[model samples]
Target chain A: MIKEFIRKRSIHVCLVCTGGCNGCDIEVAALLSQRYDLEQYGIYYHNNPRESDALLVTGTVAKQWQEKLVEFYNKVPEPKAVVAIGACALSGGIFQQESDKVGAPVSDVIPVDAEVPGCPPRPAEIAIAVLKYVPPTLASYRRKI
Target chain B: MSSVIWYLYEFARKTWIDRFLNAKTDPEIAEAPSRFRDFPEVQKDLCISCGACVFSCPSQGAIKLVRDEERENIFPVINKSSCIRCGFCVEVCPTEPKTLKTGENYLIMEEYRILPQEKVYIADEYLCIRCKKCLEACKIGAINFKDNVISIDQSKCVSCGDCINACPVKGAIKETYIINIDEQKEIINTLIKSLEGTINLEVERIRKLPDHDPDKIIKLEYPLADYLQKARNIIPNDEMIIKTVEKVTDRLKMNIITWDDEKCNQCRLCVNECPTGAIKYDEKIGKVERDPEKCLRCTICYQTCPFGVPGLYVARFLLKNNVILITLKPSQIPIRG
Candidate 1:
């Protein structure tokens, strides 16, 4: 019961940046900054996937990094959430044509929970995406009754 | 008679000169009548060499790239008869500046041309270190390293998850979605609920505040401040509540107090904290009450309430493990004194 109580109070998120340009990464990091203040919603970032309830992945899948991508996904605990942010993650975008190396599309690689598309999505959008994964309330049904 | 003879001689001389020059040309060209033919001209400077046009061309032997003697890149040369006028090469070029133009007898044909599929890089299984570096590389979050094996979750995946490109191992991760349906739904639903709760809280708080008046305390801001003061009395050491109050007040651009209700132990924190002496205990009702207008929603009374209920309508309260998540719904429920 105590474990459940602790879980309801805080949301842990893991952020990962893949092989695309750093545009999406900057936007996502802004959420944790004072301007966006994601912690107000009880959302906190975690370095370890084991402690994370949600995972935010940014960037396109490059030919060289495919293996690391899979390992990260497996490390996240069950009932975890994953969000894909950007056009590169959605489609190969410009890189799809430029490189001779064949890079995998995001959906073709892991189980994405949600997709937010843009060359680089705004910071507000990233915060909104993170907020979506937290539970609505911590009070129980019996308490209401 | 002399002028007429001169003119005749001059005309015959010119005709003889033309016949002599024509006799040197090929026999086929000499026998056939000349006709205008339309042909495509490629802009070598604009081509980025993406190969979209080259790969898209349908005519087997129609177009070939020959090195430009004066330029660094290759240029396309067309054998007129070999070109079926299909125009596939013009449609698929990625560089718009390098388009093929046909002049005069040639009409410009614009059509959608599909390029041939390029092979996607799939990770080979043997080299995987399970580091998940590629997973972080992907913005789409499609890489799933499950059970020491890397695979894709096809349904939620877009195939652009290309974390495989960053993998240290050659084929540890492949391009494919491997996760099942139930798991995906759980992730999606949780995300939705979390987002809704946060948005609703923000909206509700803003709506309760007086519309952008700039000067006076908005209805929502004042009441929330009061509620925080009340909560602080009950949980004196609760840093979370204090931080929340500070954060909210700053966001709303108002002065506020952080109430700690954890230490109250049933002792009325409000009776002491109220500035206007508005709080009064109702032993019969087993709860305290205050005059609505006189109370100021200052939340001084919340600190003494013993229970963590704020001075507002409770929308939903969920208890999971030991944590409490509360959703407060704004309402005009009167606080009877």
Candidate 2:
């Protein structure tokens, strides 16, 4: 009940970067600006995974980050949702050709609730995806509990 | 004390509030530009199944040809996941409404539109004599001879069929019809049947005659021009129809010229009259010798020979079960004495 009440008041999103061209990171960062104003909807960009309710993952998971990504996902508290941003996070993007350097998509390492597909998805699209998917995922977790 | 008062005054003014209130937000991100190329939309009916889109696509497995179970027509299907939305498929689509469209307005330009060709003219490199006659005959200069090869430019060609007419070799420059194949096959069948029917009666008459020589040659009583005219009525293009008839006649070996060595009086008349120099008197052989390889079978020697040395005969053909059976028969016209 306390978790639901906290989520109802405000949602905290943690931005995770495994490995990519950093183009999707720039677009995600755009959401913080007043133009997109992601915080207007009571969403806060928290650096800590434990405090965050949702995790927005960008870039293909490189070999080095493969183990660290699972550790990061485990750190997030229960009733947490993961949203994959950009083609790289979804399917390894153009780095798919270099199979040796980059691991498979983020979904293979951790469960993904929603996906926003584009070379570098628009900030509005990422904002919409996070808003639409995170609440339902949290609600389903509450029912399980 | 004055600096402190100035700081208080600057804080009270709040000059940054206007910029924050009028923030630039791009609410129109969903509304893409007119030329923004998204995934291609396939129009199955407009596709001619030429595979041009498939050939032109840069991304592998982005577009593939699929057969329709109900209509039995082949059309292209776009794979959304693999497609990069390059718009190459839309640009190369030859249909009017276009088989594939990316919703781009610039594709409607006159220069980008490549219409589906009804018939494409191509030169058979092996058969082409490289005489350059077609190059000269083409008014638009669509035909080119480069590096010992003759090629036709499809973009510049008007399909006027002037090059086919100017070609000395029958099959050198050919017309390949990409559309209405079944209709063309029907017309060609009718023409072949009519031609076969006309020559069938004479073949039966020769078979019934007792002690009749199969080698005997006679003139055809009826000219084939009327039957050719009937074929021309169906296919308005004279060159294509003529080429079709010529191909059929060539397969049947319509004319056979037989020369009698004894009848030649050594007058050397046929040798003088022969256009291709196929007939020549060899002093070693002590008689006139005709080279079969050089002979065009034009029947010039048959016409010029006074003593009836060279004989001309027509052949009747029956195509049964995919096999063509040819029979030689003498014509009904009286032999010149």
Candidate 3:
């Protein structure tokens, strides 16, 4: 039916790196390579948020990125999803105890859809997250658990 | 010539045809359970709070043993997120059964393992205001400025504490454990209630003028450490703060700097131990006496007393059980702030 038609069409994903170490970005790159070949699964990766159906955010959000995170989060069309891609994004991770945390946990500034906790998750993890977590999140932004 | 033709067919089959064909499911995800490494897990009951893991942590606040607001209890809280999974905490825990049990195969490389007594420098980059002033003091080129952040390269840092000496902010750089103020939430909140009331009233009276800058953010000392930090943060004596804060919730219970005459034996050792000369022998009275006003209430008299006769305990603060014992004696010392 209509769901099958939507499944075949690509999910436009925007990658937003706030201030992370960029290891997760490398994993995201691997997902698009020939081994994983994310395009085959009806997915498209880009930097622009306005065209995106999903937003994948990685890194510890600094004060400078706080406003930008909200701006980008708002730009995505209705029924959009946000994937917090690393430890810093989920709970400020290693930076949790930092005093004067201006950028802080991403959830503080914008609504988060899903959290993937790892220093840097493997490419398989990211691919699995796209298959498992993203669409359900897009269906409804409420946390699955 | 036949072999060359055969290899060309194999290479074409590998790329053009197979590029379109691949496994439907990811293999690594299936193998994740076997390949992943879970960080070390702590056994709460087994831990002795002996400062073993605290000594083993590479940096401060990584493994802290602190008490709750009640001060009647103590526990070990590990920040596994900051832990490098080095297994040093597992190795050093002295209990017959280890306290920090290594979750997976914790293979410690010699370089990753910090010795029990070794020191490491730590700084929270968020606290670092990129005022490149730390650069001018360092000659070794260990301090690097990049990405709007000034940082210490652990590999190049000499642990000389020069950066700490030069920094205008006390905790901007540290040679030992970075004393994060967030850990003392109870004391900070208590201070806020006490200090805020006075400061707000004073600010309201002064801020009615047009000269007051609206954009200037007046930072509150929310953390007790923020109140105490000087030009350089030499690790403060935590035990002293913990003891004093616990004993003197109300000033009425504070140690009167008195000693037990029954146990005094007039060793006069406590007299020597008094840094402020609070304890002394009166030749005319032919007995050891204490000048309460001069007493610093450091508990050294109780700690050093050979009799172990609950001598300094009475001087420092009345114990819950001994409050009745203290009420019997008439003390003329009026409370002083």
Candidate 4:
């Protein structure tokens, strides 16, 4: 019941790419498209960080893009959650071996609320991580539904 | 107009009213299979009559090659009967935006189809050039042209698309699906036996290593021996010896240089600068050989090497002490880092 209620409250999320191959970003967009129908649960990806309640950061934070990452993280409003999605964002993945730039794990740079681990995590896994921030009443409602 | 109104009324009554009333008992709802997000679906329009999916499909005979006589092209005809629906066809398809579409509601049992071990193709004795192109293309070391003929163990091919992409000459490497179960099983059994022997060798090597002490030197080679000897000679004090070892070992922890023979200029800069003298240049082979035992694992060599380009091609460290050493072959290197 709580799960169903949580599904009703619209969740505006911002998606950002660090220095990754864009595989995870592409998959994340695919989830929001007609195939995954993420809209049914009122979870929507927003283009602006100001309007978003949470941020989904993908890829390894490359040295060249570290400043950009920090800026993006700081721009999001307070009580805003960050979900590091993919092995690269969490542990620098394949890129860690290629470059001297040790990618700052999301937690190292910013407070990360949750992590979705995979070369590119399955879209379903991303959805579950987002649910963690939802209010308890809404969460229970989503469960009932 | 009256007929149109009547049709609309009936459609609404049946769909809205009837569906709501019968929601619990409706066969469509009751029998409908659960769906999960990201489940793949085939897009017929984008499917280029390429039979690559059919040949690569791991679900034994689940996808069949069918000739569309009218279109004069071959296409994959997926047999629902044997389709464990693991989406191998979807994942491996070379098409952009993917011909397969997976929906959120679609839930298919996630089954990883253990593909019948692929038979490694052995180049004919008369045709092989001993160029070692196939050897470099093979990720599993299954292809060896040491005897002037490409010999394949017919076991290690995972169909990971490495050899196919690496083969410079067309027709040098080809993959074909085996339809007969008995033939596949016979080849698989033989390969397993060979793999078992290799595994035993690896286990023996691993057993000889010291217990999991981080400071204990697991492997050592000439350059490392030279460095240790030099360090001892330079610093006679026991505390200085301990400090030097600690410093060298610490530097070794950060090494990350990987080389591709195709891109390498064969410069010995990395070999010379290596503090531990871990890198040895094989001038005859026109490649740098890394002595893993001697390597301090410091990534300075990687940073210094001009040929070290980042991408899927470079060798990466799998663990703190273990490094995947990629050497040049006539073709592309086989190591997947």
| DockQ of every predicted complex | 0.01, 0.02, 0.08, 0.03
Interface DockQ of candidate 1: 0.01
The local distance difference test score of each candidate is: 0.53, 0.72, 0.59, 0.54
Q: Put down candidate 3 lDDT per residue, B1-337, tens digits, no spaces.
A: 9899999989988977687676356564335664255456676667655655755665333455544445433445666434444556777778877767665443333233233323455555877877777788887887888787786666676667677777887557755432443444444344334443433343433233222133432232223344344211333556534433333332333232334466657777666655555577898888888775565454556656776422221111232321211221222221111
Backbone clash pairs for candidate 2 read none
Query: Which lDDT value does model 1 have at B193?
Result: 47
Error of 2 at B152 (Å): 27
lDDT of 3 at A135: 75
- Fnat for model 1 comes to 0.00
Residue A106 lDDT, candidate 1, scale 0-100: 73
The residue ranges of model 2 lying beyond 4 angstroms of the native Cα positions read A5-9, A98-100, A143-145, B1-30, B33-35, B49-68, B71-83, B103-337
Task: Give the per-residue lDDT digits (tens) of candidate 4, residues A22-135.
Answer: 878986887786655676556888989987767888877777767777788788764467888876777665454434475646677777777776556666667767766543
Where does candidate 1 stray beyond 4 Å? A1-9, A98-104, A133-145, B1-337
Tens digit per residue, CA lDDT, model 2, A20-44: 8898899888889877778876789
Q: Higher-TM-score candidate among 1 and 3?
A: 3
- Give candidate 2's TM-score: 0.43
Candidate 2, DockQ to 2 decimals?
Answer: 0.02
Predictions ranked by lDDT, top down? 2, 3, 4, 1
For candidate 1, lDDT tens digit of each residue in A2-114?
75566555778888877878877887787778766777657888878888977777766777667777888889765566788766666654354434353535777887767
The iRMS of the candidates, in order, is 25.3, 13.5, 7.5, 12.5
Per-residue lDDT tens digits for candidate 4, residues B135-198, read 7877678666554556555545566657656666544554444344453344333333332333
Question: Of the candidates numbered 3 and 4, which has the greater TM-score value?
Answer: 3
Task: Please give, for residues B1-337, the per-residue lDDT of candidate 2 as tens digits.
Answer: 9999998777755666555576554657535566767678888888887667765665444566665767856678876534546677888887898888886656345332155677778899999989999989999988888999998877787788889889999789888776656656766787656655555456545434332365653333334466556766676766566555555655654555666677788888788656456788998867889997666555657756888777666676544333344566654323332
Candidate No. with top TM-score: 2
